[model samples]
Target chain A: AQSVAQPEDQVNVAEGNPLTVKCTYSVSGNPYLFWYVQYPNRGLQFLLKYITGDNLVKGSYGFEAEFNKSQTSFHLKKPSALVSDSALYFCAVENGNKLVFGAGTILRVKS
Target chain B: EAGVVQSPRYKIIEKKQPVAFWCNPISGHNTLYWYLQNLGQGPELLIRYENEEAVDDSQLPKDRFSAERLKGVDSTLKIQPAELGDSAVYLCASSFGSGAYNEQFFGPGTRLTVL
Candidate 1:
């Protein structure tokens, strides 16, 4: 079964600081990794995906993720975090036709 | 293009009561999905539909949970005699196709509270 692990439950960072939310995945074959962000009372918004090629994938809202094959990690990162960027982030791996998701990491950006 | 839409943003029901949630996927989307998200947890797949056909329902609790996407556009998920454990955020998502490369658009979700 394909699965994703987000080690951090919550990450706190000051505004304008760089931020990273770690995620590691396990799959039998090549992994299709994705990142989604959910704001309060809102649906999850797609951030980025790492399907093939390009170790570093850029996504919406000045977000990017590095897909490290040997490390089996797809970590979400931003150069300068915004206070509005605070939300719950989820990492997912495509398993056949379905997607397996991580527990999610809460991002708290303090101004 | 509008995003996926779900109805009844919040609901409070007693255990054993019946509840139903509705969803309307994005226009032109042929694949729809239903997912359950518990507190502090990620969304889990409950059922998936491909053009009005249920292609995947392995994770759905068929004993009490049921869902249908008619006309391959709108969907409804129902729970008969709901259990306390069934309290969670029910999310609806849709994509142009059911492939790994296709990105899914999600709805705001319906939060169900089974007392």
Candidate 2:
């Protein structure tokens, strides 16, 4: 079955340090990958998506994700982490008509 | 443009009680979706509607859960005889033009707690 996996349950980073949240996907066809962030008690917010573009996709809140076709991974990254960036990050891949999401990874940026 | 709108930011009810949540998708968005989000997990799609038609509802528990988008606009999801395991966040999202591939706008979900 088509699925996405977020290997990390939580990622800790010092403020101003680079942060990475790992994600891997398995699907039948070329995938449409996306990243979303959810704050406490809030709905998921769209970050970025990789459809058919350059491998590097930029998104909201100063976040970006690299889509590696050979590796079947779309990992979210930020050049410099911020305390405010701490939240639940989700990776998703579009199946036929729905999005299959990973378990999620908590990104905690400490000051 | 206004984002997708949902009512009842939070709801708590005893088991066996019936509860309903409402959603109003962004204007001109014909694709609507309802998802169930368990604690510490990503939201899972329960049902999806293409205008007034229910295209994909295989994941929805038809015995106790039902949803409708009557005029192809606002929608409602009803759960009868709620159970403790049913407690979670119900999220509503909508995308313009098509489904899955387009950008989907989400609303603040209704947090449900079954006691």
Candidate 3:
């Protein structure tokens, strides 16, 4: 069985400051991780994915995530937060062709 | 470059009523998925399709729910005699490939409210 955990329900950040959203996972084999964002009443938009490459991955909208093998964590990060970044973020792990998602984290960026 | 499209942005029906939702995946995308998302929760996969074949539907409630993807382009999900617990957002997503690492593109979901 595969599962994902996002401990925080909400994360608050200030505009122009760095932000981090924590995510952890449990899987039998190697994990394929991904991050997605969902705005109000909108569908989830893919941010980044970690398949089999560098630990640090860059994605759309100046977003990035670091994959920690030892810690079994994949945390989304942004260098400078923007009000537009306020949304719901989800971390997922792919088992076979199925993706299991975490509960999600609400990100609020204050301008 | 049209993304996945879904209809009936919002639907409200009394308990025991039937409802259906539709989805059209991105052009030439063979894999399609339907997910259910409750308030403040992550989306859970209800079913998955590869072309015209339903490759996965283990999580789907076959007792009251049914789905089909005829012609392998457009798909429909139906629930007969919906229950109050059925209220949630139904989302459709598609990926370019059937590979494990394929990134999925999502559709603006249909919000269903069962009264």
Candidate 4:
């Protein structure tokens, strides 16, 4: 079965500081990874995805993720965090047409 | 372009009561999905529709949960005799096609609370 794991339950970072949310996956074949952000009371918003070519994929809200094949990890990163950037981040893997998601990591950006 | 739309943004029902949520996917989207998201957890696929056909429903709890996407444009998910465990955000998503890499657009989920 294809699955995703987000190691951290929560990540706290100060405003303007860099942030990273770790994600790893286990799949039978090559993986198609995605990152989504959910704000309070809202559905998830797509951030970025790593499908085929680029190992380093850039996404919305100044976010990027590096897909490491060896480690089976795709960690979301941002150069500078904004208070508005705080939200629940989810990493997902595509298995066929279904997407298996991670538990999610709550990102808190303190000003 | 309008995104996926879900009705009854919030609902509170007593345990064992019945509830239903509705969703309308984006125009021209042929694939629709229903997901259940528990608190502090990621969304889990409950059902998926390709056009008017239910292509995937393995994860859906057939005993208490039922869903339909008639005409392949709008869908509805219903839970009969709802339980407290069923209280969660029900998300609806749609994509242009039923491909592995097609990006899905999600709606602001319907939050359900079973008292």
Candidate 5:
């Protein structure tokens, strides 16, 4: 079955340090990967997407993700973490008409 | 363009009571989706609509959950005789099309609490 996996349940990082949220996927065809962030009491906000071309995709809130074909991973990254960037992040892979999302990873950036 | 709109940011009800959540997709968007999100989990697609036709609903619990996208615009998701397990955030999202390239925009969602 097609699925997305966020290996980490929660990742804690210092505010000024670089952070990485790992994600891997198992899909049939070419993968269409995406990242979304959800804040407390709010709906998910689109972060970035990897449809075709360009392994490095940048998105809102200074976030970027590197899409690796051989590794089957699309890991979210930020050069410098901010306290405000702490939230629940989800990795999703498009499966035909539906999107299969990972369980989600809680990112906590402590100042 | 205005983002997808959902009504009743929060709702509380007894387990056996019925509840409905409304969603208005972004103007001109031909596809709408309803998702169920549990605490500490990602949103799961409950149903998907292409225009007024339900293209996919395999994940929806037909015994208690039903959804309609009449007129190919606004949508309504209803749960009759709700159960405690049904307590969750009902999220509405829309995109111009259902293709992989189309990014979905989400609404604030309706948080339902079953007592």
Candidate 6:
């Protein structure tokens, strides 16, 4: 079955340090990978996506992700963590007409 | 664009009661979706619509949940005889089309609580 996995339930990083949220997916064909962030009491906000071409895709709030086809991984990364970046992040893969999502990873950036 | 819109940000009711949630996708978006999200978990797709047709609804619990997109513009999801286990956040999202590259835009969502 097609699915996405976020191994870490939560990740902690000190402010100004780089952070990484790991994600891996399994699908039949090419995967359309995406990253989304959800704040407390709010709906999900689109972060970035990897459709084709460049492996490194930049998005809102200084977030970027690297898509590895061989590894079947699309890990979200930020060069510098901010306290405001603390929130729930989700990784999703679009297959055909439906989107399969990973459980979620909570990122905590301490000041 | 106005982005996706959902009504009744919060609702509380007893089990077995009927409830409905409404959603209006961004103008000109041909694809719409309904998702169920439990606390601390990622959202799961309940149904997906292409224009006025429901191309995918296999994830939806037909016994209690039903959805309709009459004109391919606005949509309504109904749950009859809701169970306590059904308490969750119902999210609505839309995109330009069902293409793999098109990004989906989400709404604030309706938080349901079953007593």
RMSD vs true structure, all candidates: 0.7, 0.9, 0.7, 0.9, 1.1, 1.1
- Clash-forming residue pairs, model 6: none
Can you tell me which runs of candidate 2 are displaced by over 4 Å? none
- Interface RMSD over true interface Cα atoms for each candidate: 0.8, 1.0, 0.9, 0.9, 1.1, 1.3
- Residue-by-residue lDDT tens digits, candidate 1, B1-115: 7889999999999999999999999999999999999999999999999989999999999999999877878999999989999989999999998895689899999999999
DockQ-wise, the better of 4 and 5 is 4
Docking class of 1: high
Candidate 6 residue spans exceeding 4 A from truth: none
Model 3: clashing residue pairs? none
User: In angstroms, how far off is B15's CA in candidate 2?
Assistant: 1.0
Model 5 CA lDDT for position B18: 94
- What tens digits encode model 6's per-residue C-alpha lDDT throughout B1-115? 5878999999999999999999999999999999999987899999999998999899999999999999989999999989999999999999997874688899999999999
Model 1 accuracy (lDDT, Cα): 0.95
- For model 4 chain B, the run of ten residues with the poorest summed lDDT: B95-104
Per-residue lDDT of B29 in model 3: 95
lDDT of 4 by residue, B1-115 (tens): 8888999999999999999999999999999999999988999999999999999999999999999988889999999999999989999999998985889999999999999
Q: What interface Cα RMSD is found for model 6? A: 1.3
- Put down candidate 6 lDDT per residue, A1-111, tens digits, no spaces: 778999999999999999999999998887889999999878799999988889999999999999998999999999999999999999999876677889999999999
- lDDT at B61 for candidate 3? 99
Q: In model 2, what is the error at residue A27, expressed in angstroms? A: 1.0
lDDT of 1 by residue, A30-97 (tens): 99999999999999999999999989999999999999989999999999999999999999999988
Model 2 CA lDDT for position A28 = 85
**Which one wins by lDDT: 2 or 3?**
3
DockQ: which is higher, 3 or 5?
A: 3
Model 1: colliding residue pairs? none
Clash number for each model: 0, 0, 0, 0, 0, 0
Name model 4 segments beyond 4 Å from true.
Answer: none
Q: Which candidate achieves the best DockQ against the true structure?
A: 4
Q: Provide the overall lDDT of each model, using Cα atoms, as 2-decimal numbers.
A: 0.95, 0.93, 0.95, 0.95, 0.93, 0.93
TM-score of 3: 0.99
The regions of model 1 sitting more than 4 angstroms off are none
In the order shown, the candidates' DockQ scores are: 0.85, 0.79, 0.84, 0.86, 0.75, 0.76
